[model samples]
Target chain A: MNINEIRNAARRNAGHVRRTPLLTSPFLDEIAGRQVYVKPECLQHTGSFKYRGAHNAISQLTTEQREFGVIAFSSGNHAQGIALAARQNQTPATIVMPSDAPQLKIDNTRALGAEVVLYDRESGDRDAIGAALAEERQLTLIKPFDNEAVIAGQGTIGLELANQAREEGIRNAQVLVPCGGGGLTAGVALALEHDAPDLTVHPVEPTGFDDVARSLHSDRIEANAQRTGSICDAIITPSPGQLTFPIMRRLCGAGIVVPDEDCLRAMAQAFTRLKLVIEPGGAIALAAALFHRHQIKGDAVIVVVSGGNVDAPVFTDALNRFA
Target chain B: MNINEIRNAARRNAGHVRRTPLLTSPFLDEIAGRQVYVKPECLQHTGSFKYRGAHNAISQLTTEQREFGVIAFSSGNHAQGIALAARQNQTPATIVMPSDAPQLKIDNTRALGAEVVLYDRESGDRDAIGAALAEERQLTLIKPFDNEAVIAGQGTIGLELANQAREEGIRNAQVLVPCGGGGLTAGVALALEHDAPDLTVHPVEPTGFDDVARSLHSDRIEANAQRTGSICDAIITPSPGQLTFPIMRRLCGAGIVVPDEDCLRAMAQAFTRLKLVIEPGGAIALAAALFHRHQIKGDAVIVVVSGGNVDAPVFTDALNRFA
Candidate 1:
């Protein structure tokens, strides 16, 4: 994807999306030992930046394709994003999700006007279920991060933040983004490369699921040994997407890996300092910015808190432990 | 304070203050049964709207007075606001706080570069101590809500949100503001009277501390019987300010009083739906918008969540019971 595509997507997504605020606090700056700017996509529609991709992708569809509707397979932020975006576009949406996914997610997707089809995740193949459903309903399958339109949509954040950085008088900095399938990281890296050449992008991942980091290190695609049961479930893909890895490999700096505990602490810090409720997966990039300060350069750092679709118990636990 | 004063405060606050975003969600709209717009002053500097007034008041001080420094007596949001604003203007601030105040507030004020003077709440007279200290140092005393410049500063929110509401296509609506000493409510009421005439302003208070409501009803100033023991400490003032009450009496609609439980529930709801951390006092306006819809008159309602500096245990309790 190019700047033109991101610009086009931004134009299409204009009124329907929120240009979420860039947040900062002196308390956070002291903790990170530098100026820390936070791009809280959790404040975005559907409480995640995934809505940017979902909305853009839906907008990119042909009238006939949109009339036929769209299908996606997700049990978390992506599901809600697609559901809400499709509803806003007046396009029917069907989300194939794991039966074991949190009831809150399932209920929220349904509430957003999407038909949720749940399959057994342990034994059932989500791809097959989504494919069969798509074929039966003549629906276009929307990949969360693998598609070009979605990546371009996510790149809009890059374009917005580059200007915001300049407004804040930040000349050079590293931007840490949570790495799931590398869609957000690659998109941000590419946009920053074109707009703010002095600013570098880094993908931050959890220790056990650092596939994007390993892939960049080895100069090839890498897969995680284990996927399920990660605290950061929103970012536990098997590996980096085929479309996203190459852009990230070229444009991104070395990846930053943080532990789950640090992610929890970051959640508490977001609550205490920013008054934001961030889920564990969404807090990892912030964790990297605050905890992995030794690996970073520049006097300022920007972290993209990717999402905030977390349960109360999980959030309270974080606050209790750290706040 | 008049429109001219608010306009001047807005100009003074242009660069240093954040014009915090107006947030809304379908979920909140569904709960309120109307389009609900939230002005999260909880996201403001010092995690409250108090910063606006503090900065404006400090800036209003004469160069000689500013050089001599400023002083205030507050143990909560106001203390931190004054501390930060004073530091930003390179003016020394001395805050006389009750020794029994939460350690977090005291520490936060001190961390922001203010000198903390602790006094006993039970026996020691805070006014006497503050007056003595001010007399000794020749420091200008900044009242929390009674000062003309401070009220004008708070009025800036009304000016900002008036334009924001019109942009959202809201021609007529009610603005529910958390009422402490009525500074925010009176300021916003005055500003909206000029800028957004169709939008009425209402003061929201907790049940026991409905002094503003009683005073508005009686057409005379009234004081609360209870002095302490409130879940919403931020808004536990005995009565409205002499200056602010007159303006509130003229411009404000009937005051809306919510029970402490509803405030707690609103806090949990803000956390769950808005991904925002709101203190009990700040959540009262939102609670009125959701639970007291019958008392309101409009197809849309705007609520200002004024602060978010709750302790962890209290927040966790709200989550545990309601979330």
Candidate 2:
């Protein structure tokens, strides 16, 4: 989809989704050696930007589809997002989540009135379980990052960034977005291309799960050998999406990769300097901006903190280890 | 100070300080049994709303006073606020802090270009130390919350709440503010009285250090029996300020007291649900709204999370214990 479709999606989700704050910190600027603006999507509804896509996709369902209900498969954040979105639209939802996923996320998703189906991360096939369940119940399957409506929904954040930048009189900026399947990156790139061409978008990923970065380097989709071991569990998809990769390849800049240690440091910095609690996956973009400052082309850099759904033990460990 | 003074302070601080977002959570709403909007001043410059008062007070200093420099005494957030504000105004700052204050706060204050003199909280008088330093150096003493300019500066947050409420079409609201010396509560109450008379503001304090609450109940200044033991170091003042107490008595609703355990829970909730890091003192207002919902008056409640400058270990303990 194009920017116009994203704008339409924005209109549809205007009051339904949160317009999270774009924050800045002098301490962060000092470390980066340049101006840095943080788009904290971690502060969005359900504590992640996934709510935007989930709300947009669920809200556009036909009456009959709503009656039949919807199904989604996710490790954590997307499940919570879709559960809350479906509940708001009065549509029943079933989420397939890894049994080993953070307990907080699973409890939260279930609390939002969604039926949860658990699967083993190493041995169970979540897609197969979801597909069979959807068929049995006549439920519509909502793919996390591959659907047009969902991409358009995530693109709305790009529109907000452009407007906020214009309001601040920033003529040019480099935006670093955490990437798993390239859906958020591609959507933002397209929106920025249409609304603020001067601002360039770059995808940021964990060092081991650098599928998006490798794909951009080779000019095609790529896959990661392993995904279950990364500290950044949220953005550890096995590969780039079929639809999202092409759009990202066309409109996005070269991608960046950050190690888990840098992500922990970024999370600690966000807590101390920005008074923000950012999960590991959500901090990859900020890590890239801080440690890879030399690669940035513009004076101003915007880092999108994508989600904050980490377990308590993980967050405490990050703070202690980094400190 | 009046609403016009607050408006002027807001204009003065327009570009200097961040206009922190007013966020909402459905989980929080469920707990409060009403719609709750959070004004997270924890995201403010220097990790607290003290920066507004410090900036306004320092900015209004006379040329001679600016040339000589400024002095203040505090254990944490206020010291950093004054240091940053004075540096921004090109004025040197000397801060008298407790010897046992958090190492993080002391380091942050010094990093901002302030000379820190540590006094033993149990054996030394910080006020005398500050007075002697001001006398020797001819430094202007910027009181943390007692001065008119400082109170007016803090009142700017009230103006923002009124405007934000109007934008959201909320005609009436109950505002909960974490109180130390009652400056924030008094200032906000006065501003709301003039701008949005329908909105009632209440002071929330830690149970052991409920000086403002006791003073409000007695209609006079009352001191806490102990001064230095509360976990909420940012707001452990012994008594309500002479100037701030009168204003709170005149305009504010009855004060609320929350236990330290409740504050810990609030901090964890903020981290998990709002993706915001809030200190123990900063979480008291939110704790009041969550645990003391029946005390709130209107259908819409606004909780002002006043600061976020706790040490790493303290924050980790809160998250772990609460989780």
Provide DockQ values for all models, in the order shown: 0.84, 0.82
What does candidate 1's lDDT look like per residue over B1-323, in tens digits? 57999999989888878888889889989988999999999889889999999999897778899899999988578899999999999899999987877666788899999999998866788999999999999999998888888899899999989999878888789999999999899889989999999999999999989999999999999999976667887887889999999999999999999999998899988887788999889899999999999999879999999998888998999999998
TM-scores, in order shown? 0.98, 0.97
Candidate 2 Cα outliers beyond 4 Å, as residue runs = none
Model 2 RMSD in Å is 1.5
Top-DockQ candidate index? 1
Clashes of each: 0, 0
Model 1 chain B: which ten-residue window has the lowest total lDDT?
B98-107
Model 2 CAPRI quality: high
Write one digit per residue (lDDT tens) for candidate 2, span A1-323. 79888998899898888887788878899999988999998888888899888999999999999999999988788898899999999999999998888887899999899999999988998888998999999999998899888899899999999998998877778899999987788889889999999998999999889999899999877899985888887889989898899999888889898888899899999988998888889999999988888888777899999998888888888899986
Candidate 2, B296-318: lDDT as tens digits? 87788999999998888988988
| lDDT for position B181 in model 2 | 89
Q: Give TM-scores of chain A for all candidates.
A: 0.97, 0.98
**Cα DockQ of the candidate 2 complex:** 0.82
Pairs that collide in candidate 1 are: none
